[model samples]
Target: MSEADLIYTETLMQRGKESYTGKEIVILGGGDGGLLWELLKEKPKQVTMLE
Candidate 1:
């Protein structure tokens, strides 16, 4: 990941726990499945990626 991507991921980490924890998350346009992998680290109820 690029520096900007890392920064953005860090930002998400800050907000993810409150918003995504234990919630079903659907990611649209996630062809590479990167977002799905990232979110899975948070231990959500479920995570789905659609391309």
Candidate 2:
């Protein structure tokens, strides 16, 4: 998917926002992580890439 076309499933988005909250999130897969990394920039303390 293109950078602008990436979409997170509802559950993933909810969990990311709720459970993950302010914790660093480690993304296991690389495909979607790029886009996630960008979206997460707003909440820098809430996301990280592993692959």
Candidate 3:
């Protein structure tokens, strides 16, 4: 992944890590699936990808 990719993913994941647990998440425009992959590690209640 590119630096921007890492930065974007980590930045978002870190910010939401605590709040994501057992919560429903809606992801829009994460076509690469990187965000989804990381989000799953947090074990959220549900994940919906619009794209």
Candidate 4:
């Protein structure tokens, strides 16, 4: 991935931190749990990822 892509990803992650804070998150089509792995970093209130 390019550096620009990495920056964009970080921006989105920060946005998620704001929007998903103190909320239950359900990630549909979380294939291979890749998204779950990223989310686990934040340690949100709750997360249920269905693949």
Candidate 5:
């Protein structure tokens, strides 16, 4: 991942937790689904993952 992507993800995680809002997650490109799985643990309503 690029530096910008990392920053954005960290920011998202923080905001999501603070606001207690589950995001409708979406991913583009290809890679492992580990991140999505982790997000699910945070009780996100749905993950519209595309890989």
Candidate 6:
């Protein structure tokens, strides 16, 4: 993963790796789909991206 992806997917959430676990996530304006890709690794309940 890229540095920005790491930051947004992990560091920015401030809960580390388990941040997205079983959670519903919505991503706004992630046109490149990088954030979606990284977030999926955490196994969130659902992920919706609008771009």
- Report, for every candidate in turn, its global Cα lDDT versus the true structure: 0.70, 0.54, 0.86, 0.65, 0.59, 0.77
Q: After superposition, how far is residue 29 of candidate 2 from its true place, in Å?
A: 0.5
RMSD of 4: 3.8
TM-score, one value per model: 0.63, 0.42, 0.76, 0.55, 0.50, 0.69
Residue-wise C-alpha lDDT for candidate 6, range 5-35, written one tens digit per residue: 6676555456554578899999898867777
Off by over 4 Å in 3: none
Q: What does candidate 1's lDDT look like per residue over 5-47, in tens digits?
A: 7667657556544667798887778655556667787789987
Clashes of 2: 0
Tell me the lDDT of model 3 at 44.
96
Ranking by TM-score: 3, 6, 1, 4, 5, 2
Off by over 4 Å in 6: 1-18
When 1 and 6 are scored with lDDT, the better candidate is 6
* Clashes per candidate (backbone, < 3 Å): 0, 0, 0, 0, 0, 0
Q: In candidate 1, which residue pairs get closer than 3 Å at backbone N, Cα or C atoms, i.e. clash?
A: none
Best-fitting candidate, scored by lDDT: 3
- Minimum summed lDDT over a 10-residue window in model 3 is located at 12-21
Summarize candidate 5's per-residue lDDT along 15-41 as a digit string, tens digits: 455532475666664255545545667
Give the Cα-based TM-score of candidate 2 against the true structure: 0.42
Q: How high a TM-score does candidate 5 get? A: 0.50
Candidate 5, residue 6: lDDT:
55
Specify the poorest-scoring 10-residue window by lDDT in model 4: 8-17
Candidate 1 global Cα RMSD:
2.6
